[model samples]
Target chain A: MTIHYPKGMHHTSQVTNMMRTGKTTKKALTFSRRGMGLEEEINVANDFYLANRLAVIHKKPTPITIVNVDYPARSAAKITEAYFKQASTTDYNGVYQGHYIDFDAKETKNKTSFPLKNFHQHQIDHLANVLSQGGLGFVIIKFTSLNENYVYPASHLIYEWQLHKGKQSISYETIVTHSYRIPESLTPSLDYLVALDEWLAHINK
Target chain B: MTIHYPKGMHHTSQVTNMMRTGKTTKKALTFSRRGMGLEEEINVANDFYLANRLAVIHKKPTPITIVNVDYPARSAAKITEAYFKQASTTDYNGVYQGHYIDFDAKETKNKTSFPLKNFHQHQIDHLANVLSQGGLGFVIIKFTSLNENYVYPASHLIYEWQLHKGKQSISYETIVTHSYRIPESLTPSLDYLVALDEWLAHINK
Candidate 1:
């Protein structure tokens, strides 16, 4: 007997089409148009990067506090009750080319500005911690409506986070000027590492 | 309404007691005697490490594929159906003093050899990948029966993994000779970083 799994829960074949066309396929475009998040796309890209031995980044699993578990006969243990816990760190983190890369991917429908509310205090703290230890920390912000993505450094985000305490948002102009724009690609989809290299070079200079 | 969560699911008070006594408490001793896992102890250590700004390691949450969710009025979404997914990497990973540290904590009741079957192939591969990228990868193997823990480096494990193709386990002698014995402590419990430093120095020599 075969068990049918739910869609979007597993790796999707959209990666193959994206690899071939260097863009989202008609099906994927439709799915995204219907409000599917950028997370799936980034997961696929991370998979691509891992397969090619380019990077070893992974999305940290959602922390859940298991309340009750059931053991059915001759079957796997099932979590009958669980509660989602707030993550203390970012969504993605791993080693890339001997550098520790830590970041989260966020998408904004607002084309004018990216709300600081999209980031949490703990995440900012985690990123700052990574930076203090000589690691690379940044966020990949996708202006979904505008069809653009930017690699905003943690330092810049922290600055804006403190500067706009009352305002609570960073204008698009500030992001575009302060952040490095990630170039779109076929296999990796969001090649944010390119932007990371540029940002590292700029900071070092 | 108050929710009485299960014990050991959240951060336990064992850490505070351990901090004061520099050893496991009576309750923790009783729990361990009753076959409770080492995951809780390690988690407390990780917490202590993070709080002191010494390291930023964390256990990757168990991946679960959610099939159904229900959003009740003004409450968090409840996952009605979900299944555990196989993790692609090791359990614990983070930046430590500008070095990327990745490892998994495993316990075995066997008094002699540690069964090779205790580790998954994917985890071995992931560790090898981390090693290739100049990161530190090791396994903290606890011999529960003997009340001892050892930090086994990834390179040694990979070597043994290939050497013991026909054999199913690494002899106790082999592990003791090849691995660094982690000195147990109060504040951090298992101070494996000390073993890591020795291993690094050995490799550099």
Candidate 2:
């Protein structure tokens, strides 16, 4: 039976989509190679950085409110009921070179523009708060169809979100102009820290 | 039937203990007031700081490995099966005054010493990593029986944990000497940031 799970909750949906297409051609192979979710790519990069002692970043677990549990005699405790809770902060945060880094990762299939709806009000508020406290706050946006990624400063995002400009979203051209491009690579799939360093250097200058 | 839930899993157990004792005297009232769990007290303090824009600290939600979810028609998705997962890092962390702050809260009933068993190996390693990254790392320890709270540096905790000294825990006297005392108050309850400032000054000096 098919189930309609909330966004970010059902990872299996991506797998299902792949299975339905069932294309084994070269283009399909390339599609599968680049089809990894943004979250997974970030996790892999984090693991690499952690192992090398470069930084200690982590993705906060999805929040859930547990209501009931069952414990058997010789097994692990099992949660019988729970519900997801809306997150008040961004998904990723940690310390990097004495700097507090906070950001949320998002991906869009849109070819022309990135929708502002991808960001929640609380997340925007959280990034603003982190920035006010002198921490570095940003968002990692991936244009899936175009296979492009950008590390956009949270300050610009907040401005764009609140500006009520005729456009409800940020055009690709604006993103390319305002954000630092994250060159994709093999070792750290996302290689976002490079973009982060650039952003940091730009702000310090 | 009584269930032996793991530590930090059953908050209701504290309430159960209170109900079982059935104490309503003046002394019991005092006990209840001071009996608020260390986690809850820290949460209250964090809320006060956030409201006043003093800090952006947050307690991460407990991690759970969800296995099954069910979505009923016109209703929110329900987590049908899940299991608690061991945390990979500290519980509370955020930007404080441009300093990346990371810490875990723990309480002990023993009056003489804080047991090393109260800390997990991963937590110690995580603290060490954060400290190495130039972030502020510490543990908020509460001696429940004594109604005393301390903001103890993670450096000291790591030292004692790895020293293999004759004792299995840090003596109360040692903690008093190396830690900053957090005085309880009405609004914030646990004013740990004051202790943190003191720690920072001492380290800088």
Candidate 3:
């Protein structure tokens, strides 16, 4: 007696076998080379920091309101219906060496400017509130097209946000002038802490 | 022609009318006097604090994974299927007065002890991690039956948790001895910050 598997299934099994044997196959190589999104890279950096006990930052979960649920036999309860709720704060916040850190990670494809529309008024207000409480608040802007990232302080963003009544965006040149560039690395992919240290030094000086 | 309303609907409308007219109907008055659940009360207190710019604490949204969704015409997309994801940290965290505050608000009807079962190992580990990073980590425990609330610092809780290999709960006496009593108030109802200030003062002393 014999069993047959589909071609795709056989291919996947071969890849799994290669991974188990520590052999880098074409699929494995492609997976390794695949570029993560800005959020994914930041999450990976957070995990690295957590494992090394350097920081304790986390992305806040998306807000949602469950309307209906179902309990299946011998399984986890499933949400049958839900609605997204408006978020009241920025994306990431936590403590780093006794300092309160809060920031949002944003990416843009446009290389010329980063539109202010990427942020909401409520988010700006929340960041201001965080700043007033003496916490560090900033935004990590990734210009994907240019393969560049910058840590723009919340204060600078707020200033531009308030002044941009007629303007719709912050020019890339202005961002380059005012923000600290976040150097990319292999282990902690987006080392925003370096930028944070520079910003702290500048403010203190 | 008169629009007919159901009996319950009419009763509710009358109660609402009484509330609007500043006339306290029996039902309306009872509703006003009824105590809110611990979570609801905390939420109300958070709103009050935010409005008054006293604090910036917020409850992290429950994480969920969307498996299916439906986009209806001219309306928001509805999550048709989803599942709750395990949270990696506590419920509430934010900056207050240059301090990073992280905590979970819990309630137990048991008048004698707080069952350690209310906490999970992951939450404890997360709290420890936060503490290592110099963040203030604690739990706001409400003895609902006793109408009492206490802020139990993470260090004390972790000490007991590590010592209690087979113990199922922490005695009320233990909590009373180690925790700071959070006096209830009208505006910022929970007023956990008052307890926090006391804890900080004691530690500094």
Candidate 4:
């Protein structure tokens, strides 16, 4: 996991080289960027978007069930016994431009393909349910090794999951062809909304 | 409180009287209904709505911040230290008939007015933000003494909250005049969606 942290010296050197050459390739640009976790990036982006009043989105807090709580004088109540609970819906959802938006973000170390096992049956079902209600539903997949992220439509994922028997993964090629790449950017950091807009336009067509 | 629970024998006797007379008033109906908490009632209604494919509403789990966890061998992770966190948004939100729905539910024993103190500033801000983004935002108020529930639009609540300086509450009279009543029902228990539908129709007019 430490290895995944941005190599500070190596990254700085690459930026210096790129500056001196006055030209940089996409790979060089990607390598120069820090390897922030997908969830954190999205959260930062959400905060930025919210501050700008561009969209009202939130990552639902992780669900937990509590068995006991202790109260002390003049202090906040402390949970004593609790366990994580499986979420029934996606991790993220809110309203954007009058459209209901819902999605989950996942980061995978696999470079060749994204395993379907990363998604739970209930989440897939939840996405399908939201879609039927005319809401936009999707998943953000970050290929950690490749340092790339894509916004994959829940409809497409559900189709593949249901249509195939024992086929356990979606290949990188298929993902690249079908999904919109979320570009790395400043301010909002990871501008997934741009990818979302592109996907929305494509689907509307 | 135990006093809040529906009186079993007293309630049964009332029902028996109503049955003997073949006349059940609205008050009788309200009294006969179990005194389930507002949150629990909404959860039950949401479950019914989900199962029937009528709506995709859900009660967002109570937010908590965990500080420590213990992993016992061959056992699920146990949360050892945690504390509740104030939620930034409403308790319930989802999609219904292509409309984004967002709201919080509160129950009060006050027969005259619903106290504004029931809401937090952030929750109010969140509702305003979502409403601006074209989502339907509202608060559901259950008058425990009256056994009546009303869906009060966030627009009205926001207006009152902003306009009235030092005013502490919204009178029940104003609520009844301006909001839709959520009726007690069979399949979905407390059918707030029907009130929502009515509210939507009224607003569209």
Please list the residue runs of candidate 4 whose C-alpha ends up more than 4 Å from where it truly belongs after superposition.
Answer: A1-35, A165-167, B1-32
Note the residue pairs that clash in candidate 3.
none
Per residue, candidate 1 scores C-alpha lDDT tens digits across A1-205 of 1212222222333345346544346445444444446787778877876776666889999987767777889987777767788998999989876778889999899999999999888998999888776678899999988877898888899888878762478999999998888654544556566676577668779
Q: Which stretches of candidate 3 lie over 4 Å from their true place?
A: A1-34, B1-35
Q: Is the docking of candidate 4 incorrect, acceptable, medium or high quality?
A: medium
Give the Å shift of residue B148 in candidate 3.
Answer: 0.7
2 versus 4: better DockQ goes to:
4
Query: What digit string (tens of lDDT, one per residue) describes model 4 on residues A141-194?
Result: 999888778999888889878976325999899888889887655445566877
Candidates 1 onward: DockQ, in order: 0.41, 0.64, 0.63, 0.65
The C-alpha interface RMSD of every prediction is: 1.4, 0.7, 0.8, 0.6
lDDT tens digits by residue: candidate 3, A1-205: 1212222222222235335535444345335425878888788878877877778999999999899999999999999999998888999999987889999999999999999999999999999999888899999999988777899988889999999952599999999899988754335556676677677768889
RMSD in order of candidates: 9.7, 12.1, 13.8, 9.2
Over the true interface, candidate 4 deviates by an RMSD, in Å, of 0.6
Report, for every candidate in turn, its global Cα lDDT versus the true structure: 0.75, 0.81, 0.80, 0.80
Q: By TM-score, how accurate is candidate 3?
A: 0.82
> By descending DockQ, how would the candidates be arranged?
4, 2, 3, 1
What ranges in model 2 sit over 4 Å off? Answer: A1-33, A165-167, B1-32, B165-167
Give the CA lDDT, 0 to 100, for residue A60 in model 3: 93
Residue pairs clashing in model 4 are none
